[model samples]
Target: MAFTETTARLTDQGVMAMLTSAVQAAGASGQPQCIVIVDGSGVVLASFRMTGSRYLSLKSATAKARTAASIGAPTHTLPDHAKAALAAATGGDVTGLKGGLPIRSGGVLLGGIGVGSGSGEQDETVARAALAAIGADDI
Candidate 1:
């Protein structure tokens, strides 16, 4: 029986690059943001709250990152009916917010990125820009 498998993971440099890209995107949108990145195991890798960003949004951003990483999908894809239940069941660790996106490379799941402190569209745009900066697959 095969008991071992190779896995891809995000490097520190890659995380930094993604963060820079997210920050730029948020700036371009004229909205400061709270950004979170999480490993596939739902462990936070990096987080940033830009100046002028809403402090409370950091909580939702973290939840969104965890949710995407845990599910290997975008948090926004969660059904509307399940959003509340998922949040409640997970003690708000997972969310159905639109800014969470899975980070993948060549079809391998690496982690996730989440952004907040703006409209859903703006948040998503920032997250997507980060993924693009790292050449991650789109969802």
Candidate 2:
């Protein structure tokens, strides 16, 4: 039996690139955003809040990142009926917000990214930009 398994993870440089892309995307959209990134285990790796972004959005952004990492899918794909229960069960560590997307490379799960403080579509666009910047698979 194998004692361990190989897994993909995001590097610091990749994370930074993603962050930069997200910030630029948010800026181009003219909507300030709170951004969060987490590893496959849901540990936060990086976060940023743009100037003039809603302060409270940080919380939701974190939850969104964790949720996407935990589920290996986009937060918006979560069933509507299970949204509240999932959030409550996880003590707000997870969310069904539209801005979270799992980060993958070569079909392997690496992490997740979440963006907030904008419309759902805008937030998603920023997250998608981040994923694209790193050549990660789209969610």
Candidate 3:
């Protein structure tokens, strides 16, 4: 038997930049959000909760990140059927929320980021800001 595999991954610096940018975006919008980053394997790499954010948002943020990383697509962009099926398959471990976005670089899947605590659109805005910070917003 032989096994060989390669995968893209986010560096620690990338995580920091992402979190910082997302937080700033949320603050500018007058919202407190919980931000989370997950690796390609759906394991959390980093996370942050703003001082005024609701505690439940932490779980929502993590689920969003895991959904994006596991499905390799932005949560909000998934087709309706696909989102339903994925949610059922994951038994709610994944969420099809607008705040989740896959992180890619050079056409390679690296990880995902998620933000919560505000409306879906607000959360997505913060996530996009984080992606833009690293020039990964094209994905």
Superposing all C-alpha atoms, what RMSD in Å does each candidate have to the true structure?
Answer: 0.8, 0.8, 2.0
For residues 1-139, could you state the per-residue lDDT of candidate 1 as single tens digits?
Answer: 9999989999999999999999999998899999999999988999999999999999999998988888889899998999999899989998998999999999998988899999999999999999998899979
Question: Which tens-of-lDDT digit does each residue in 1-139 have in candidate 3?
Answer: 6598776678889899999999999999999999999998888999999999999999989989988887888888878778778778878777887899999998888888989999999999999999998888485
Residues 12-47, model 2: lDDT tens digits: 999999999999999999999999999999899999
**Which residues of candidate 3, in runs, are more than 4 Å off?**
1-6, 81-89
**Against the correct fold, how does model 3 do in TM-score?**
0.89
TM-score of each: 0.97, 0.97, 0.89
What residue pairs are clashing in model 3?
A: none
lDDT of 2: 0.93
lDDT per model vs. reference: 0.93, 0.93, 0.89
